[model samples]
Target: MFSKACEYGIRAAIYIGQQSAELGRRVGLRDVAAEIDSPEAFTAKVLQQLVRAGLLTSVKGPTGGFELTAQQLATVTLRQIVVAIDGGDMLQGCALGLPQCSAQQPCPLHYQFLPIRDQLNEVLRTHTIGELAGKVHDGLGFLKQFT
Candidate 1:
């Protein structure tokens, strides 16, 4: 359960990575938003965060937008994007959203949820954006509508 910003950031990064990896195409904010089915303005803000995090590069004026380097496309993982946008706190926070939840003072579901969080972190850590994009590029994945 990522924040809305984090959700958009993951989708936008994978989509941008796919465009770069598949066609060497640079993506505009509007096109990225439409492709990911996110709000243009909010997506713009989320993209700026990714740019600041060094997960993406951007330029202004004509022919300027956002893109990932070839190396980044192949290596940046979902955990990196989520942490950059959502912070490390996201991985450690209470699944039940309880302020005092922890191992010492566990929430109703804290013990049950901890393993799920750990598994999620491992999965996110291992899955590269390129892998997810590869799925879309190879017709094995769907970002929004199948295409």
Candidate 2:
């Protein structure tokens, strides 16, 4: 459902949220990478991208780290992070890399996949990261822990 970049972006964002919730403080890239089992350099690069995209903030000095602004952390959607890292429609693209995929000339997977894709997209669009966190917290037994 997501590329490596999108996966890392979402994981890093969630890690930030979880760490902030636990420590009541921002988390650094090294710590986040360790927590999430992501490559340190790659995670740092993604963090930089998120910072540029206004989804995260970084502080410098002895206490330096990355933290999402209140609005960015609360109101931003998973879809936004995925799109920021992977573009608007990873799922909507050609499954076989065909350029002219559509209703008139659908790709191999398109006919069987469009409805599911649309449903998933709708779900992603409706949920914010804060809402997702609330759900995860409420359903921790059923939800998978990432880091």
Model 1 TM-score?
A: 0.90
TM-score of each: 0.90, 0.83
Whole-model Cα lDDT of every candidate shown, in order? 0.89, 0.75
The weakest ten consecutive residues by lDDT in model 1 span 138-147
- Tens-place lDDT digits, model 2, residues 27-127: 87788888767899999888888888887788898998987666765777887787778887565676676888899998889887888878777876777
What lDDT score is found at residue 99 in candidate 1? 78
Candidate 1 regions with alpha-carbon error over 4 angstroms: none
Query: After TM-score superposition, what is the CA distance of residue 102 in candidate 2 from its true location, in Å?
Result: 1.0
Itemize residue pairs with steric clashes in candidate 1: none
For all predictions, the C-alpha RMSD in Å is 1.8, 2.7
Pairs that collide in candidate 2 are none
- Prediction 2 global C-alpha lDDT: 0.75
Cα error, candidate 2, residue 86 (Å): 1.4
What are the per-residue Cα lDDT tens digits for candidate 1 across 38-131? 9999999999998888888887878877888888887899999999998987688897777789779999898899999999999999999889
Q: Pick the candidate with the highest lDDT.
A: 1
